[model samples]
Target: MKKFDVLTPIGLVVGVVMLIFGIVTNGGITGFFSFIDPASLLIVLGGVIAGLLINFPVKDMKHIFTVIKQGFSQNEQNLDQLIKTFVTLSERARREGLLALEVEIEKVKDPFIRKGVLLAVDGIEPDMINDIMSAEITAMEERHRKGRNILEKAGEYAPAWGMIGTLIGLVLMLKNLNDPSSLGPNMAVALLTTLYGTLFANLVCLPLASKLALKTDQEVFLKQIIIEGVIGVQAGQNPKLLEEKLSAFLSSKERQKAAELITSGEALNDEA
Candidate 1:
């Protein structure tokens, strides 16, 4: 299945709705247009970017767009289906030997799972397999941490920049206090910078960071399942026992499907 995510669009719609509703309630369309202060925008956004660039390396900044995309993407791991497949592979390996898994390896879609199974079929020592696979998992986690930290820093820095903009605006407004007309526009820039900062931090950066964290948990869980299942296969575990062991990874609803699949012998049938 495709892993497209809906969070990005949903969050954007909600934010836009909030801005529009707040503006329309205040002074209709005029208030909405009045909020468009280019100087305020530049101060908030540009300052935030500049702050981030200083805080993090340029290479990390280069992947900001990619990291944001990943935040919105789904992990696409179906636990019930995965458990069933593992059960099937274990039974085949037990009956016909690990070499029998060679054909099945080609059908496996996830590269991480495929690599683990390939190592098992190749007769790699269980300890060696564990070492290699565990290293990969560690590296995956570190990469995820880096991406999350970037967003987190953005969340942290946004408000700081916003405050800077507010101060800048305040200074400009106070300097032109004699001109009453300039007061309103200058004050608007100050307040708008704060609003932009708050919106970006709460509505975008922080939320994306949280979402990426949740996604990392899911991907890590799926990868753990693969690592465990492959090691069980290498150990020549009984298929039924392996199924029972792997079922621990599933939720209550998924556990029911797992039980039915094992009972009906449908999981083993897939190997036929």
Candidate 2:
């Protein structure tokens, strides 16, 4: 199922506000179109691309599209549902033993959870299971860092390129000083590069980088929950005790919700 995210809408709203304000301030839609200088766009965008190419390998550069797609996609982890599933699994393992998890592994959707359960069913030591899962988590973190880093570099380079475009505009305007009337027009055209750069950096690249970091945090937090859940299962922890332990990951309000789940016997019912 797809879930709606507020990030994209927030970004779009902010962008639309800037667009409308710019058009109105510049004396309507026609004047706003005058701000569109192909040369400025080339300088800002081409320079950003050049900077990215310099800072990251081509393989890493390829991930920009993937990151954009990921930003719009639904968050993969459903913590509440995950907790219930873990509790159910823990109760079953406590009763029928780890071998029973073999039949249930096929029913698990998350590959990470399934793998951890399978490892336990195969009698791997808890420490070894942790070591393997921790390594996988570390690898996931590194991949996310790579993507965030690319957007960060783009944000940094954009403004510098914009300044470069401003300088180029100044030089050209000065060179055409013989036509004094044309100077202001030439200068305005040059400054448009800086405007483009600022807009791209502040509105597009920086926000995207921040969003990617937020997404990374959510993913890592979810994975940590899974890791803890799997370890609790392996050690034959009581379902209620395991729930209490996992509840530590939530906030005060969320903890209260979990407590209600326990008190209302909803968790016990799931175990049954």
Top of the candidates by TM-score: 1
For candidate 2, what is the lDDT?
A: 0.81
Residue range 1-272, candidate 1, lDDT tens digits: 44779868798898889879988998999879988889888888898888788888888889899999886678666777777778878888888988999986777677787899999988899889989998998898898889888889888887887888889889989999999999988898889888888888998899999988888887787888888889998899888788888888888888998778666665322221
Best by lDDT: 1
User: Model 2, stretches more than 4 Å misplaced?
Assistant: 1-6, 256-272
TM-score of each: 0.93, 0.89
As a whole number from 0 to 100, the lDDT of residue 179 in candidate 1 is 94
Which ranges of candidate 1 are over 4 A from the true structure? 262-272
lDDT of 2 by residue, 134-206 (tens): 8998999899899889888899999999999999889989899898997876787579988899988888888
